[model samples]
Target: MVCVFSFFITSCEQNETIEAPQTTTKVAKKRLFKAAKAAVSKSKRTPSTSNNNHAAKRIASIDCFAYVFPITIKNGEEETVINSKEELADYYDAVEIGSEPEIVFPITIKLEDNSEETITNLEELDDVYDSCMGEETPCYTLNYPLSLVQEDFTTNTSNETVINSEIELHTFIDMAFDKDENAHITFKYPLELTLSDGSISTIENDDDFDAIDSYCYNYDDCEDYDEFDCFEVQFPIKANLNGEEITINSNDDLEEYISKLEDYTFPDFVFPIDIKYTDDTLVTLNSLEELEDAFDDCFYEEDDDTICFDITYPINLVKNEDTENTVTVNNDQEFDAYLDSLIEDDYLYIGYPLTVILQDGTKKTIADDDEFIALEESCDN
Candidate 1:
């Protein structure tokens, strides 16, 4: 019975046709959080060591151009910045650069870092600027307008003088004297003169200045005056002796004058027997006897037959205690031997007056060892 039912179903299925099911096509959906997960993973990764080293090298390097700013050159109120070649050229033209510049002004240098430094004067600024620009020497500005304080000392009739150097100072002095011939200069303030060798001479007071000025004014006149006349006038017949005119009349008067010769000490005796006239006339007598003879000749000029003793003794020896025993020595060798004997015996040590007549008919009394030695040396020579 079961076999017959299966055969009946099979026969019904074989008669029925099987057809495919039909539906709308659909695409697979993508994960929405995938991009966000990848981004978080990338953020958690460690930076490379090479990248860190590169950053440190960049921080260590210095930028010289950025830190260094253009220099600004200043003179008084005028100023200019030197940065580009054009700017430098413009500054040179404005300043009118030249070989030499006299007036120097203070300069101010500014940097890009907002820092500033001041150069004391134009010379110092020139040195720095020239060095920065690799110049061999300093650059000077020509004919820069400069106002200066000037102290003038010159005559109205003479040319105007400015005291700039020592030479100019001398010119100013000449001009000052030319203006007023009798004007006396007094330096109230101290003046310092520097020589070429760098020595400093200071005129501190009015007295020194006056002395120098007087010397300068009287130099020519003093040079023209005869200096030999001074000796003649100083030793006149009735010349001033300590502000008193002393009269030397006769032999007795001359002897008294010689006794009181206080002008010179021993070994350097100054005899009062000599008289110098204003005409450079020198009159000297050897002894009192000669002076008496000269006086007699002057008194009896008309009496030619008066038998005046006009004989001049070549050498006369005078002894102090034994004036009667004094002798005249005519022989040169004899006088030299006598001087040698005196020196050998040291006779000058004894207080005995010994005088000798010189070849020029002058009497000199040997008073000390120096005189004795001098006589001895002269005789030996």
Candidate 2:
């Protein structure tokens, strides 16, 4: 009986010893997995924060231009006024890590030439910012042997291509777009990327790739029309500069004449001015409206569905030549309501001498019905 009890106690002791290591191993694996997950979460990049920091850094280092004082900026729903460079710095330093601050539109910026330009939108602000930064686009060296799947739109078929170099990758993307603007390319994941810091990071999927792939657009090709391809005003042009007749023999002459003009006064060109296109085509512009039409022929020839300009309110609107029944539209809601009130065969006219803000942030004044009609026709094209 003594031997049996001793044997049973020894068996229990052996079982406990064997189970101890297994429990410890399971707990260790759980802890390791939790730690790994936490590390991944911490390392994932926040694109908004990254972009905001980049913008802030660039703005702080800007030397070519300065923001107009008492600029309004917003973070989420909260707005703040930045009165000086010191205040801007403080705001940048104290802004929440993930919060993005947007500059309010119509803020004026002082250029190096002492000319102040009112930036009407984020695109205008970006143009100024890019000019100050020397128009640098962020790009990174991508690892080779990356696989891309190209799909044929007509046939609904796909083929895999292994890109071995950056040039090859660029050529492939360009060729794809050249064939069809709607061409689709799917990147095979688990590819590695070499960051600016010379660190290698793996892209697991499209989301991961989108986070770091910043070279998504070309700065030079962003504009609808190439400035060089646009029509050039033939020299030795006659214009009434501040109501005084003057001849601008060259671009320099025009500049000199413009410099002498009083503030807010513009040259009224004597019609019919001649313009030459790059293709050796000559167009005779009968008036300022016709000159603008020639420009529209070059710029708005593309089939763009988006609205290219915005009218500044409160613009006066008159329906069917009823000058006494003029209505002032102050906002988009009012403008929409005015449109809804219009019926077929009802002629609507904007009260002359209104301002329009173009897509490129240029402000132009419409003098009369003819100029306004020309402007509307250009936008429609």
Provide the TM-score for each candidate, comma-separated.
Answer: 0.16, 0.24
Top candidate, metric TM-score: 2
lDDT of 1 by residue, 97-167 (tens): 22121222344454322245666755554444444445433121112121111122233221211223221
Per-residue error for 308 in candidate 1, Å, reads: 42
Lowest lDDT 10-mer window, candidate 2?
Answer: 39-48
lDDT of 1: 0.31
Model 1 TM-score?
0.16
Q: Can you write out model 2's per-residue Cα lDDT over 104-199, one digit (the tens) per residue?
A: 777887765446899898667666666665645445446866766654544666666665554335434543433333345566667887776777
333 Cα displacement, candidate 1 (Å):
57
C-alpha lDDT score of every prediction, in listed order: 0.31, 0.50
- The stretch of ten residues in a row with the least summed lDDT in candidate 1 is 23-32
